[model samples]
Target: MDIFEDKVILVTGANRGIGRALVKALLNHGVRKIYATCRDLNTMPSLDDDRITVLSLDITNDEQITTVAVLAQDTEILINNAGVINAGNILEGDLEGMDNDMSVNYFGTIKMMRAFAPILKKNNPSKIINIVSIAAYSPLPSIAGYAASKAALFSATQSVRIELAKEGIAVYAINPGAIDTDMNKGSDWDMPDPESTAVKILEYVADGKFDIVPDEMGQGMYNAWREDPAKLSKIFSDLYYGEISE
Candidate 1:
């Protein structure tokens, strides 16, 4: 339905990385207004566009989310792009880090979705795009906790998609592979730049794709997941344990 052009969109974690790239892409796509939010307004890059409004937001904070929902009542698209990855394994890692992963990545995103669902309904013909990860399909041993959180979000996306169907709020889950962002700075994966990844994401969103695997690596993982999840899991495990090399 050409959701981008002239649409009122709200993007979380817009200070940098994918969220920042998405804001730039949305500007190029001719969106009417964009509510770009991040945990710290000071860190937000200069986006000198009349159509954009910068706001402070930490998705984990209920009060901040409520304020944003109230302020951006006209939003037609809510992009849950805020997330964190603590470098830790499920078994020997700090339990607190795992908890933090679930808190912001899973719980935080869910809260934002719930808060904005009503606003989206009022706007009608709206969309909610959750920036999930291919890790949702198979656990990466290094950041197993983050992978688990994404997995939870992926499952929630499926459930909410069905729930929001009758209400005309199209819910989409974007499963991106490693992208060139600070979040993946420690990784050696040949990741695509965030700008290209963001462009691909919106293209799929406008195309009405429910579950979007946005990059080549993520697409391969998605294909393997569809074919056989257990096999994919083993491959990830082997890679982590140095049984295979990319």
Candidate 2:
């Protein structure tokens, strides 16, 4: 069965980057409807399809998340794709930026999941896709706080997967290495195309993979970590800008 062929999907951060790509992918798959959300509705580009509904949602805000849950009652797939990136070391980062990373990347997703889990359960055989990152497995001290937030999300994803499986809600966590987006500029590693990454994501979702290493780099990172995590951690911490990263 094609999981997305007739489903109602609600995507957070649908305005740009991977979220926008996913919207287009769903359209191509002939989904019934898509409730596309961004913090500011004005930022979302208009789509010509009648099946698309735009909504204003800041996942960190309780009222907004509740309103979305009420409004999008028929949603079958919840894509927790919205996130924030904070720059600085964990020891002495800007408090607001660090807080924002956790709030948006970790807590914000928690809010969305809490509000929508029941709706998805009611919809039975539904799915929840959380867009985590390769950073979830390791640390980049340059953006230490952001990595920590994703790491927290990764843990939550695992627990959600096991708990929700009894109810037929398949939870998917995507860990993509470096995607070419405004959020991922100036990276030391090769950044894969966002559209390609998005396509790979949906393919994995259809294939029913719970934890996905979405791109080649991500797969390599996963394999390397599995082989010897200590070696990879030291590589990231000591020589992130050296030959191995490239």
Q: Which model scores highest in TM-score?
A: 1
Candidate 1 is scored at a TM of 0.96
How do the residues 1-246 of candidate 2 rate in per-residue lDDT, one tens digit apiece?
Answer: 377988999999999889999998889897999999999988899899999999999999999999999999999999999998988877777888989999999999989999999999999889999999988988777788899999999999999999898998999999988788879777665778888889999998888788998899888878878999875587577744563366
Task: In candidate 1, list every pair of residues with a backbone clash.
Answer: none
lDDT of 1 by residue, 93-168 (tens): 8889999999999999999999999999999899999999999989988888999999999999999999999998
Model 1: how far residue 107 lies from native, Å? 0.6
The whole-model C-alpha lDDT of candidate 2 against the native structure comes to 0.89
Off by over 4 Å in 1: 243-246
In model 2, which regions exceed 4 Å deviation? 239-246
TM-score of each: 0.96, 0.95
Error of 2 at 127 (Å): 0.3
